[model samples]
Target: MDLCLKLGLLLVIYTAVNASDISVYIPQIAQKITTNVTDRSFVLVQPNCIFTQYPTTNVWVVVALNKSFSTISDSALSTPIPYSSYRNGLYNYYHTLLVSAGKYPCLPSDSTSNKVIQIGSETCKGNQFCNGVLSNNQTYRAKFILLNSSGIFDTTKWSNEIILQQGKSFQGNTGLPSGRSGGMIVLTSILSVLMAFLLLSVIAALIFGGRDLCWKRTMLNQKHSDRNMDFMPRSTYRSRYDNMYLVS
Candidate 1:
């Protein structure tokens, strides 16, 4: 049982590493863990964040379903994807986006724009792009390809994983595979109950402690009043003693 558990943990770690590590494409890795993906109508880049491979001609971003750049099979990579014989092949493609110096320059570096990429199921406008469908609560990734009239000459490693959010359909940003179910609801309820107990304990302590202190102070004040009364003379017996002294 222990060996099985260890192997399970190791497998999870390996998949996570493969999913997020796009070192070559992104250079500096951001420390964010939230899902930064979309299934928007269009995927266009701003002037500063434009995807470019200068001195090369144009840039292509090939997207795949549940795949990293390194994991893509060599047979698929070696085969050109039909339209541009020079373009690199993608075995199981979902979407493609093209950026160029004419429309957008890839020169400027913008980390903020790095996380934004257009994704949808509809076909793109030109031969340079192919459309892919995105379902709710699915994870996807993309890689850059430097293309010219000949197709693709160079490419970058895969980008970080994107967990696409679909309106009310978005599950969460757990980054784990979909269709997982268990005792999550029960666990959350248990945690909430524990928190409530802690808060109540604090309140009860404050009220009870203050009540005891007030009772002690009230008793002390009453005792002092009673002692003062006890020491005072109730009546005087001076009349008889004075008369006897005068006669003597």
Candidate 2:
């Protein structure tokens, strides 16, 4: 019994060690568990440029990632200057704008003029960029992201992280084998009842020896008769014999 209890405790410990541990996460934005990023889109538009209205001309689109505006050093902005009759510097002459809206003011362009612009060779945070430069009355897709590690843009990289809450665990219940009942609980209950019955039986056996079926010393004496033995005293038998002779 002691060995069986030790074995049961060891089995329980082994089961606990082998159990599955899970981690879960909740995002501020709507996201699913173990998901991949896909179908991401963003538009660049002049805030003041409404359907019927227009603003001062000469604006460009600039995209960036993981680079804060404040961290940018002044020496980094050493790109070739393009002379424009309308305006040279845009959005306070900031080359990299974090917002999707391009350097505002969608100005009209001629057919011969290149509607789409490109800063051919410029590096932002060591990443070479090739973005669409849209003119007035036109929209260009900025699908190509300047990833530092990889040459092309990938949602798999720029997508949000899956934050996980750790240490959640569970126990497994599987298909049971045949002819095996609940051993521990059943055996415990049976032991309790059997112990009670065994104690009562022991007490009765101590009080009543073997059984009533065996003959005792007093019972054997009652079964015998004293008439089967010699009944007279010796002296009295002799005197009776002598009187009988004298009379003859």
Candidate 3:
């Protein structure tokens, strides 16, 4: 009987330790990358998190612009209500809408889940629907709040400030420096012009050198022909007449 009791106690202790070991990790937001789709520019935002023991029921993510960390902390503390249940207040206080787990759909038992959110030039219309689009060459930050089905927020599990920026080329704003495509085009054009100029210079040099060599050869041939004419034999009659005069 005593052995049975000891074994049962050990089992309970092991279960408790295992359950405590399971913890939900804070979400990490990836750096924003700009991409062109159908002649339009867009920013891709991907945030990821992991669960060891517990299954994730819901996730609330938001992107705030031009706000400091202290301000975000204050707002987060002030609003104990989950974003799913309360949205109007969230829009008023925060910058953007909340993305829930239901919309994204991730397996709770999975070690990690990465969800993508796309921000386009038209996303921000300066209306109540969404916060205005992100500015070009401007820095922004994102926040992820995890919760359960009962709208209970895990204050301890939250993301740190994830910073990202948009390039000047985003959304047809060409005021900034050149992008990858533009820079390549400019460089290629310059190289092509230089190559053409070098080829022309080489061809001109060869043509002029050949002409100079031909002129020198023609002059040397003319001089040699004149010398041969001067050395030719005199008429035989003229030579005989001179010998007869000497004999007389």
Candidate 4:
């Protein structure tokens, strides 16, 4: 009779623990990079809540296939809360969101939340640990998963869907330049080539043109020497010889 009572109590305790599952909230806002969005990399604005609520904790920036999670209208995360936490450990380990904390934490009085982080493979650094590379022209949704000493504490809701488009170069976030800078690079190259061609033309003119100019100067000098010979002043001997020849 005592053994049966103990088993019943144990079952009740287990049920109570299991009943309290992880909680989910709407995904926080992710500021898409308006200026320099590229195929392999982008930017995201850190959520405002982390600075005060979970100062010691860090954040993880994650991207997955579009429509994989609940839409904005769903109110909560699309996947099972427990499963999402599980995937948090299993997926993208390299991308821990970066923020300043501790002695130099974000101030509540500050107007903005925090500095932004660039989400490219090359741009990702410090605590980020996921694969660090992103696909080009692939559509994906992004969110922030908060982490504490134990593990994942909570996750924000999914941000709006974004598409990373293809650009000129190899794949992944390996520093492929984009936006205004990309156009500037091409323009600069064209200008460099034209300048080189112009330089060569000037050099050729100097080499051949110098020789032609020298020849013209020499001809003029020769003409002047011939004219001087024809107008030579007559000597006394030459005048006598001329008169004798004329009388004969």
CA lDDT for candidate 2: 0.32
Candidate maximizing lDDT:
4
Query: Which candidate, 1 or 2, has the higher lDDT?
Result: 1
Ranking by lDDT: 4, 1, 3, 2
Name the regions of candidate 3 deviating beyond 4 angstroms.
1-58, 65-67, 74-99, 102-115, 119-132, 147-152, 155-248
Residue 117 in candidate 4, Cα distance off native in Å: 6.6
TM per candidate comes to 0.37, 0.17, 0.35, 0.47
The candidate maximizing TM-score is 4
lDDT digits (tens) for residues 1-248 of candidate 3: 99999999998887656343223344344243334221222333333323222333454444444344346563353343432222333432233344453453343434233344554344443444353344444334445554554553433333453333433335434553445576777898899999999999999999998999999999999999878767766765567678999998
Score each candidate by Cα lDDT: 0.52, 0.32, 0.48, 0.55
Model 2, 114-182: lDDT tens digits are: 222232123233322322122222111211121222222211112122222222211114333333446
Q: List the residue pairs that clash in candidate 3.
A: none
Separately for all candidates shown, the number of backbone clashes (residues 3 or more apart, or on different chains) is 5, 1, 0, 11
RMSD of 2: 33.3
Q: What clash pairs does model 2 have?
A: 24-165
Candidate 4 C-alpha lDDT tens digits along 93-167: 123344433322444645443445556545333433433545664566667665565665565566677677666
List RMSD in Å for every model shown.
Answer: 20.6, 33.3, 14.0, 11.5
TM-score of candidate 2 relative to the true fold: 0.17
Ranking by TM-score, best first? 4, 1, 3, 2
Model 4: CA > 4 A from native: 1-22, 30-46, 50-54, 67-94, 100-136, 164-202, 236-248
For residue 34, model 3's alpha carbon misses the true position, in angstroms, by 6.0
